[model samples]
Target chain A: MLDQAQPMDEHLGFEALYCAHSDAIYRFCLRLCGNPTLAEDLTQEVFVGALQGFHRLKNRSSAKTWLYRVALYRVRAHRSRHESRNVSLEGAAEPRSVSADAQYAMRLDLSQALATLSPAQREAFLLVKCQGLTCSEAASVLRIPVGTVKFRVHRAVNSLQSVLSDTPEASHEM
Target chain B: MRCSSVQRRLSTWANESHRPQEEHRVQVHLDSCEACRQYQSKVTRLDYLASEFKPVTLERDLLPNIERDGVRKGSGYVPRVFFARHWVAIGAAAVMILGATMSTRRGGAYSASAQEAVRGMESTELDRTAYHQSLWQAAGPHQEGQLELLDQVWYEAGKWREKSIPSFGGDRIFEFDKSSGLVRLSRDWRGKIISQEETSPRPKQIDLQEFCKQAGIEGAEANAEDLGTRTLNGVSVREISIPTYNLQRTLVWLIPGTNLPVRMERQNEQHGSWTTSWLFTIEYAKSWPPSIFDSSTLESTTGGPTARASQPFHDAESGTTNESRLSQRSKLPNRNQPAFRTGNIVFAAYLSTTKPGPIDSACASERVAAQLRRPLDSLASEYGTLQSYGSDSHDTDKDRAAGSKDQVYNLRFGNHPVRSVMSFTLGSDGVWKATSLKVASSATP
Candidate 1:
């Protein structure tokens, strides 16, 4: 929601939108997309989309929900097409090849345990813990039940405890 | 198990994702409990550092594509009403229904009187081609003469003074010969009218067995017991209401004293309860032409079911049916008239939007009712459905319902009502063809 988002009277009124929500939105996209290069591209596209249909908006308060809905749709589309894990995540996994080996080293020192999580768990964890959203709101964003959100976060936390507690389940399973 | 349940609670406490009331509850819990506190703090660093690891940004270039998509969708022009004319377009298939004689007060506006039941009229538009195709394969092989009938009757509902006329809309497919009396009904007749929004109250007439298969319900019988007889809507009739079924299985005022049914009410049951929400009445009926019940019109296998109970408990409502009268057909007559003459009638139609068309005013005049049937029946015959309900709205002299629409003469023998004219046609053999029928303005009766 923005005071500047007044029913796009000007054709390129979205230029203001790009400056307004772009940073926080880019941060959201960065986490969701898991790659800086792709995230930058997705963040711009999301704003462009919001601008194109800005005339139909009756209320400015709805912009948050609308922007989030659009951002997720793009995230889902990107996920579908890129079946292979092509981009380097900051700390999740050691990608097959990368130009940013120094960046990868710094990422590795952060927390290698997060790399062990399932994609669903990682998404739930990131939306809840990193973004400071409640489990229910994160569940809403992820389109999952609150219970499943709790369960995945629980398992992630348990595994994280194990990774640091020196009694990891991976040791038993392997 | 102790740890497992608490682990769920721990998951609840550790849930940093959902930022709603649960998070508030989890935050309060963590402040009190030592085990959860250590657990949450461990969860904090693990997830916090992990989230930033894959921090990526949205690609900006894709915005053009999304914008292009929105513009393309908005600019692409399509007339909203264009697809409505096509029968299969999911919007146009409607039977021209009208008439529920209100007991009007001194000023000619509708008012609810003690006698409020729609009756005997059977009107429905059937796409007869589907039945012919499906039956050809199901029946294996048939002689050129074998005929299958999927008779549908749509009752015309009357209007009231409140602009609150209870419209009876739903389709019933009673395929002539099915072993279990497997009648497929959507929007049960004999229920009180419920909704305020307008939708296609009638669903497409899918095959009965296929309908059951889709709904995941057994078609043979309804799960109901007899609640016994009671007087409903002034008709001393059997009242049968089924509550524990997938769909509304009740049949209210099902048995007709006159040839036409007094009224049929469908009560929908959801979540172990029923709401008396829909109504259909058939107030007018005379014997259909002799040809309607002829053996040649029989569609099902001879040994197919009659009124017998084929599955578990059949609805007690249908118990009164006379199986001996189970003739595969109940066809409307197809009369032989070759040329347009003095008695030849033509039916014409106008859409509800067609600039205050002829049929709009026709509702007020009985003379228009007579003149319109010829072309309307022609439309019906094009789809291979024969017409019933005699030229005089009241086919039989023994009638209880009183509406002037019943008294109008269909000189050309067209029986279907002209609501939205689905099509127009001319018959090859004679004047009865829908195309051949013509409409000329007549002196107001």
Candidate 2:
């Protein structure tokens, strides 16, 4: 139950900090990298960085948002080092209960559509939509203005709509 | 509002930050505009599709590992004190009953300093040494059934052999010897060999240095405390304890004269009582016979025929003995009775809270009903179906005294990656009841 307003104090140990934010930070990293394994590593790296600079965090209320900033920085650095590797949203295991054909088709179409988005748009869309971050919070994480985050998310949504609507399944369903 | 402006506002609309007047204005425009509504529908679908991919739950908690990393990096954050005393001597009878051999006397006689003993262990050459380690739950056997062997490994020089019955891997035996440089694997199902194969490009070799590093031998040496000598199975050995962070303790026993460790045990005091979580027994030998590394030996040991032709192993055709295939057929979960399936009831219990679904009345067992109600009560605000509950490892034991079936199922709660392992036990009447819920990973501070 760690909220933004929870102040950093002596009672809050490193273990508590991790449990509250680990899931959110991990999902954010996954959306950024599109790979679970890489997301896990980046999540670890981000926490390790947080541990080192924990005392320097003066704005305790923005702790969760600040952790996302660290994750963004680490993912950027990782992508630079492993430039040859491509971000893949494919290979995610579909749930057993879901309709295999329809789920698989939607997954394939969405994967292609997401791949078409620019890195900035993808980040903006993921933060606001997938990770459930507010535009202002996402803007802080992305180190951009709130207006810029809105613009990018707007463009990303429009682009995804255009690409996905082209699919036969989308046409039939809509 | 114009259509263009309304669309821009719609993009950030998911944040639900629109002013009341602006929202009404956008609603008016969207009501008249078919294009904007279509655009909104597609965007909503896109969001739904992208939400399908969740980050994989980590197999193990990273707190201890991250803490170790933080310590290594020498961060400014100072960790709290772990142990009150460096050297603590508990009653010998208690230790002996718990299967830890320690001196009976108040301060029994022991040779060699803790440093010397650790040095001997650190210097012990593992090049030609044979190593064997097995994991066992201390109280599990005494509580209900015999001790369960979670993992077993045998390694000598470049030769290695491992036999495990992980929930995912059923019963598997794998071996590799440097001379052959080939990995021989055999998988068994219900005491019968299902498949056997020779895989090339041998598994990675774990040298002595790497083994010691992984085991934190150096860390143990730094914090080693002598716990006096005791006779373990007629062997004269000295015991040393290393108290680590978080109330966890590691005890290592070494041969009195040789100073080579013969056993290492990890104990946790989380349940208000000390329990040996993992025990590693080591034995050193000059060399092992080639037959030990052979695949035929595995077949003979597991009591399964070496040739696949001898056994009728077809996944689709059950009752021939593949338990995995048999479980797959029990898909229809009966509400009045327990599902009798590995993962069905847990998901049913989880989903019962979110919305009306199967197993509402079928949750007859108080344990299962409590599990169903507890999540809903705690997570009242957030409600969602059980997204994914993949049981990676499953182990079942028969409690003859209690006349019940004990089972462990690993589950990952969606979005929140808490690795919750729920244990279920079936009573004599053949009713499945959840025995315990253990959270393998807790949120870190």
Candidate 3:
């Protein structure tokens, strides 16, 4: 939770919020868009939009969730305008931590499996499992009920299981 | 607890704080059941992978980029130069409007003059432009030659929809929506969808630049030879041949008028002679049917109802319904409308820096034609041809007056200095004709 004494409308307050939440938001955008350059652009756009509407942020404690809502909206708007097609992890720069070829292949396969899930399920699952957000927190970010978030995440897991089961060796490739 | 219930609890167990009793029951079920144990193991593996996959760390601080765009740390001010400048800066190549024309195709030798033609090819907006292509593999003449259809692709904006015609299974349609970051693959047999799967979008070889690199021998561009013009399917196309050191040959056929590639043929040196292996034939489109990109909604040309009338695919994030999107597409200026036709002709004339001939003169009255001439010549002389044009609605009152006898439109030509207002009237031949053009005062912001 942010310090309530520092108002988000001011420069120092916003900077504090930005410093605290920018990396999380950036990671979320990258997962959503699959393009580092575009994700960075969207991250910048999210902050700009959030700063403009800072006054509407009534509860300073839920600032991270609020920023996520703004990021999702900005990403959807960008998609509508550009009509961009498939951008895969294959095109992205290789992650420095990953050294083994088998592990890299497994990651690619996982990416392909994740794509099979519905948009709603994917968003829910990413927030809870990948982003380390609780179901309640993700529900707040998505503006859906907590039960719905759990249901979507459950369905996403089942779907991933079904997809990965086709190539059982994928998980064991590493 | 059953395996299903245990798996559900296990999926969200990390995110939820459950009761001790419920947790104990789940643990007991997992210990007793091997299937549930495997499921838990799979879940754990996926969790590890999902966390490790990408494992994104910030490459550069975005706070600075955001701050540079007027979202200051302690301030509430955002400048008007917000997304447009930043978007264009990053996407300059995507939005660049080139008025590139084909140079005269020279014969035999690869000279400096041919470089102009190569530059024209490179500058062509093949990626940004909307096009449909048919991939075919041709057998040799001695081998009872026939062109086998491998795949057909329709591309618009950044979205690509490809149909792979394989011999084993039914035809499959793979759609890659870049905007939504989704790839939908559907199988269709006799215009009926057998099965459909939506996956994460992965890019295929839809780019000519990428295709050239893969098809050509290394440094094919440097050693390219211009083979001049050849008539293909009744249209004249210029051929550029790039032969590799490994006895591989790639011939690219480009339409002379638009400088867009129509076909690329790859050949191999077999028996000390070139034999064509496969070719990709491209067709450019002004616009495509809305349903072409969505396989679930596509009306099959094979006389079968490929569309599932019960459920239409909905893009929830776009905030616009498919019906609404189709309606919005319908509202755009009909290319066949005489007024729009005249506007297109005038725009084309402006592009070529040439005076309109009899056809253009026939569409306008003497007064309106005279009014259009001076500014057209001056703008053409100073700015060259306008790269792009779209209907601008800055003046709502002017647009509201549309469909009346004297219709007014504020058309903004891209890559220009001014935004001009054009007025049209119905001609005697039941076509809307340009009546007058107002320029000079409407300077672009």
Candidate 4:
């Protein structure tokens, strides 16, 4: 069992926190935003929020979850602000210069499928499936119920499976 | 269980969330039913695919930027309810008005000159193999102490590299290879490579044009005013200030000949005071040595320091002789008093004695409290341990001012590893007060 009281270390400073959890936060944001640039901005914004409200953090042990919550809030804010601009997730998933390997192709397929998911489903699935957070943890981060998280994750998985299966080059097992 | 129910439970079972009885029922159903078995297989494959998805890493660590800029406007602590209720409408309206005004504004001579300079910069073909050095510093009452950094970047087609070294913090070297889209970060401690992390492919490159566009100076909101020429490092440069939202300003010193910015400064109006929060000076080089970009060579050149095992603070405390500890405690001034003994006694005393006659004491106290809380809040985010020593009081001079006699207390506040001593002056009625605080550095010791 992961220690519940381990996130906030009174002895740990900002540098240490950045060193420890920044990569995880970055990955989380990247998976949600799809666009690397947007993810980077959102990640930075999360830390900026963390810096401002550090004193108001009541449960020091829940820093990681708290950071995810902040990131989710920032992502939502960014989406709502730019909603009128007609931003598309599919457009955000531009091809990168990676090797044309089977694994890469499958990853690309997964990326497209992920972009097709509803925002709530995508978030829940990413938290529970990709990021490896428990349903309860995902609920806490998303500020939704555990049942809702599980349902969203289930729906996201079903949608991804369907999309991947329908692709022209669906040579991969799934 | 029915096929419909079994299909629903299949996802739960695949996620390992179902109870033993449910798992047993699911297993029995999977054994008995073909359609549910296929559904289970698909869910399993989906889970596998999801697990295989790797997250893209950032090209560079943004922690330094956050530390320098502090908190931006929207990210601050506004009540969520209030923001939700009012921000959307207010923000949309403001953006529309600002957009219309900016679009209609005629370009002045200064603005035209700035645009020409920017155009020159955008058109200039950067060298395929180039080296750049940038020194970043904060200038204001609250300097980002220990956060100042120098960046040395080496760039080639499809590859970019930078080594950032802080004055008082750790050094980091980042290499982003566009071909592989992989970003590698090597963190150094005491000349040794403490750790290294390689991220997934990040194809985007940091383009100066993109930066200019993001700053709202490319074409959208060209409010830049060229402030003639100034000599910097024996080169003539054009200085321009671009007014941004929230009374923020971006000042750039661009070399007219090269159209490249030698220096850029950001000023923000924070709490009724305009402070130059960010300053950057860039220097260009024709080329860097090939060996400098090689990871193995760089690692070998920066050898690890002599390794010493670190002992816990508690262990060191326990090892100290009781007599010596007692002597050290006895040597401390005002040992019997409740006042905090800070490093900068003069500044603390001056702040405590100086009265803000016109400023409301309650408002002043709140402002002081907020200012003092900024660093502590930052430290708390890092999980820095805070220790507070009991407060001590001292009587202030009654003859200097006609107001009531005041008692000042020195309070010790420390986020372990970093300490600050603050002085607070309270009037006789205990309503009026003044506070001054300073962060203790190694120099103070």
lDDT of each: 0.33, 0.44, 0.45, 0.43
State candidate 1's TM-score: 0.29
- lDDT (tens digit, per residue) of candidate 4 on B1-445: 9997777655544333334455567667766898976786566556545645633456787976776555454435321100010111111111111111111112222344324423312122223332211111111111111111122333333223233221112333333433443333333333533344443321123233433552323331355677798888687878877664334666777767545555655565433545443343444431222332343332232111100001111112124432232222111111111111111111010011011011111111233433334344343334321222112222222312434332221222222343344445445764434344454431221
Q: Please, what are the lDDT tens digits per residue for candidate 3 over residues B1-445?
A: 8888887777776566555567569867876998977776566556645655424666776755676664455546532111111111111111111111111122222234323322311221224232211111111111211112223334333333333221112333433443443334433333433344443212122333333442322234676777888887788877888764345566787676544555655565544556443333444432222233432332122210111111232433234433342222111112223322211111111001011100121112234333344444345435432322222211122223454233222222223445456565545664445555656354443
Task: Mark the regions of model 1 whose C-alpha exceeds 4 Å error after superposition.
Answer: A1-20, A55-62, A84-113, A164-174, B1-34, B47-445
Provide chain B TM-scores across all predictions.
Answer: 0.19, 0.29, 0.24, 0.27
- Candidates by TM-score, descending order: 2, 4, 3, 1
Better of 2 and 3 by lDDT: 3
Q: In model 4, which regions exceed 4 Å deviation?
A: A1-11, A87-108, A166-174, B12-18, B71-445
Give me the candidate number with maximum TM-score.
2
Give the local distance difference test score of model 3: 0.45
Docking class of 1: incorrect
Predictions' DockQ, in order: 0.11, 0.18, 0.13, 0.12
Clashing pairs for model 4 are A10-B383, A10-B384, A10-B385, A13-B382, B181-B201, B338-B391, B338-B392, B339-B392, B339-B393, B340-B410
Poorest stretch of ten by lDDT in candidate 1 chain B: B135-144
Model 4 scores a C-alpha lDDT of: 0.43
Which CAPRI quality tier does the interface of model 3 achieve? incorrect
DockQ for candidate 2, C-alpha atoms: 0.18
* Model 4 CA lDDT for position B388: 21
